[model samples]
Target chain A: MALVELVPNFSEGRRQDVIDKILAAMKEASTAKIIDSRADPDHNRLVVTIVGEPEETFKAGFAGIKTAAELIDMDEHQGEHPRVGATDVVPFVPVTGITIEECTELAKRLAKKVSDELGIPTYLYEAAATRPDRENLANIRKGQYEGLKEAIKTDPDRKPDFGPSELPKAGATVIGAREFLIAYNIYLNTDDVEIAKTIGRNIRHKNGGFAYCKSMGFATKPYVQVSMNLTNYKETPMAMVVETVRNEARRYGVAITETEVYGMIPVDALLDAAEYYLQLNGKWNRSQIIEKKLTEME
Target chain B: MALVELVPNFSEGRRQDVIDKILAAMKEASTAKIIDSRADPDHNRLVVTIVGEPEETFKAGFAGIKTAAELIDMDEHQGEHPRVGATDVVPFVPVTGITIEECTELAKRLAKKVSDELGIPTYLYEAAATRPDRENLANIRKGQYEGLKEAIKTDPDRKPDFGPSELPKAGATVIGAREFLIAYNIYLNTDDVEIAKTIGRNIRHKNGGFAYCKSMGFATKPYVQVSMNLTNYKETPMAMVVETVRNEARRYGVAITETEVYGMIPVDALLDAAEYYLQLNGKWNRSQIIEKKLTEME
Candidate 1:
């Protein structure tokens, strides 16, 4: 089975009832498994993680988006997190036996469906972006819902890939296909946030570090964390990044306290590291994993 | 879905047509997957590995055993490996969402069917052993086919678990449930076989080593190998065994050349080592692997 992961971010997170309604609608529409759902009251945004076959996951994502659009009014919605729609962004991540190009096709087809059926403007971002300028999600969501409302009408550059030039009460959704994003946070022994920030800066792609890594520093009560998002684990694996952080931290006389894998990660990501440490010198694949073989049988 | 892995050893490795017929019979009988099959000419035995649901796997195992009994004449069978039947042994390994007790029940049920339907005697071993003496396979298989044939008529202890006192031409089968076995071999850089034998003795269960490990020394052309069967990976993990061997080899002024995982191994065996090296100290489990979650969804 070709597994695809859909993470749809909705703007209404404060109202639990509204998020529950949308979740219920998604459950009704598709056979996809909703693995995780986090509603941050501060951001007022609900991020739902669904994974299944491409068709089912796309349908589930659409159902969630439709429900969010019906219940969440973009004009009244307010959150700390930036958003341009009730269904802010839906990115299809290739999990297993899937390609980014195939996911991009699913994203584009869903974007057209949402535009035609619900009369919602949709912007393509990341791998499915029609225009290179709109590739980054932040670029497409540069202006907030209110700002985009005015800009969509006057600014030709701000026009969406689908739907009317004018924005609707639901606002515009940015849908695309992208690689699996691993939200990993490595905690340092020291309480110094500066050390974390320095390591993050030294390892992030933007700062000429690993190509697929985007890192930042965060301070908790006990320790500092070098929080990272590995956009493409194939290009720059999790272990490599962890090793780099460990090496960098050693210079600051700090050690890695512990590492946290924030959400569900692909089996291959961990298997790669496992094979490396074991120095396995045989033909090994995911099929070797009994559970993985069960999925194939299904 | 609960997974049960059945490895059926048939005493007909010299004949390709016989093993093929047995494999074909299994395919026709159940939906279980034949993950691997090895025919050892020296042993004159065919070890077929099938993994699936308990019911399906049991059915497949019976079909293979039945086919082997019909095709193979055990009286004429000669092999380097010890055996007492055409279908020498059928062990059910609990892979996921299953227990050893459940597998034992399945083993007993299948043993009864084989005895009653096919007229072949069945002896339970390992976790499914009826008596304390039947716990180890070697204990029951001590007399081999010819000796067991003569003993069954007179010796009360040699009586079959599920068949008549008179031994059939096919002989008796040992069926039971057990943990996943990892056939791991680590080669020492030294040419001396004594060092390998010494290391193997230090790591084997009988010699006060790892409780679940069964190790022996083998001379393979240039280097000596510490060939081991890790009967229970959960009790004696792969990494710990490797580390022990590494330490032992260092004591003899030798180093590890390479290691070989001879056959199919469980995912947890590798994941345990990966987590140990990575120091992943958050909420981490096998379900976090995307493929594992897919199995749960099924």
Candidate 2:
């Protein structure tokens, strides 16, 4: 069976009650399984990870979004992370036996369902975007919640892809279909933030690096990090990004202390690296892996 | 959940009715999923692969063996592959969240169940063997079906690990637990079988090669092959084996044209090679892989 992964980011992360309600709604779609869910109080974001059949995932995502919209009031929400609605962003990632185009179709169907049923304004980003500007989440959410609400009234370009022109009290929702984004962070041995920044600049696309890489520098306690969002792992692999960062960091006399996978990552990224390193000739199929065989048994 | 894979070899392979009965028995377990099942008329053997929760796998294996015993008579069975019973050899392999020792325990338990219920004599080989002599399946089944039954009367060393003193008309069964053996074959561009044998000898453990590698040379239609059974991939990785074969084959002016994973291989084996090739520093966790995330969702 084909598997689709849904990562729904809700606005309220501080309140356990709000998070529980949204999770319960997702669980109502029994066919879908909750892989991981985290409520970061600092970010004030409740990110719920789920995977299942495409239909079940769609039902679960809609149920979770509906619950979040009812419980979270955007006017009262406050967090370090940017948001435009109660259900801030919902992304459908094609996991197995599915294509990106198919996921885009599902995203559109779900967006239409949310607009018609919940009266929530929705803007499709990434692969599901109707407009070129809407192709990026950063572009779609250029203005924060309050700013977006005002821009919708004043700016013709600010109108959402779905729902009314005016944003509701709960605010607008951003939904899309995108490849799995691996939030990878490579920590440097040195505490010098400048080194991290330099490495990030050298490897990130914005600074003339890999096409599918987006990067930034951040400091956390004893270490400085080159935080990266692998936009398309197939186009530019996680290993390549890490190696580039390593090479750039070496020029600054800094070594990689460790790396962190912030969230979920796809298996293909690892398989691609394996094929390259092993120099395994011909076509390599994942089904030959014993773990894959075991999963199929399940 | 812990996964245990059962790959059972049966004496009969030419008859579809016999293969169907064996597969049906495996399906009867419900939880055990048949990953791969093939009947080789040339080899005159049926190899069935199934994986599931340890308990479910045990149940399915027992069911399949019982069905094979009922349908196959060793006295009338003939196979090119070495065998001594209807259910020739059953090897329990640990895949995920399980240890080889745990699989060995499962193999012992399953062996007892078969002997006690079906009155089939069973010999434990590999990790589950009580004696060093019975550690190898080839050593245990040296005499094959016709010879082993006669040898059991006089040869004190040929005694069965379980069941009655003599082998039944269906023959004795070999059951054990072992580390997952990845049967990898690298086909060379040149059809010189001697070059393949020389390379195989240079990389195989028996001839001062990799510690966990066992290799032989064989010819298959269009190419000469360096057929290998990686006993412990963790110790000597698949990539290392491939590289060693490649380097050795170059002495005879032969290039490794392609490689084939004969059956099932653990994802770790491939991932290790990827890490080496990619030079990916820090958090290179299998859990970060996308396919693994999907499986966990399941």
Q: Which candidate is the best by lDDT?
A: 1
| Model 2, global lDDT | 0.84
DockQ of 2: 0.53
What local lDDT does model 2 show for residue A17? 90
lDDT tens digits, residue span B132-210, model 1: 9999999889889999988988999988799877667788999999999888888888789999999999999999999
Interface RMSD of 1: 2.4
Tens-digit lDDT string for candidate 1 (A1-298): 7899999999988988998999999989999998889999999999998988999998898899899989999889888999999999999999988999999999999999999999999998899999999998888888789899999999999999999888889999999999998888899999899999999999999999999999999986598999999999988998898889999999989999888888789977887787776666553455767666666777
Give DockQ for candidates 1 onward, in order. Answer: 0.51, 0.53
Error of 1 at A22 (Å): 3.6
How does model 1 score by TM-score? 0.85
Q: How closely does chain A match the true chain A in each prediction, as TM-score?
A: 0.88, 0.82
Candidate 2, A1-298: lDDT as tens digits: 5788899899988999988988998998658888889999999999888888899999999999899889988889999999999998999998777889999999999988898899998999899999998997888787799899889878989887788888887788888899877787888888888888887888888878999888888876698988888878878887677777778888888877777777666666777777655545564677787666655555
Once all C-alphas are superposed, what RMSD does model 1 give against the true structure? Answer: 3.8
Q: Rate the local accuracy (lDDT) of all candidates.
A: 0.89, 0.84
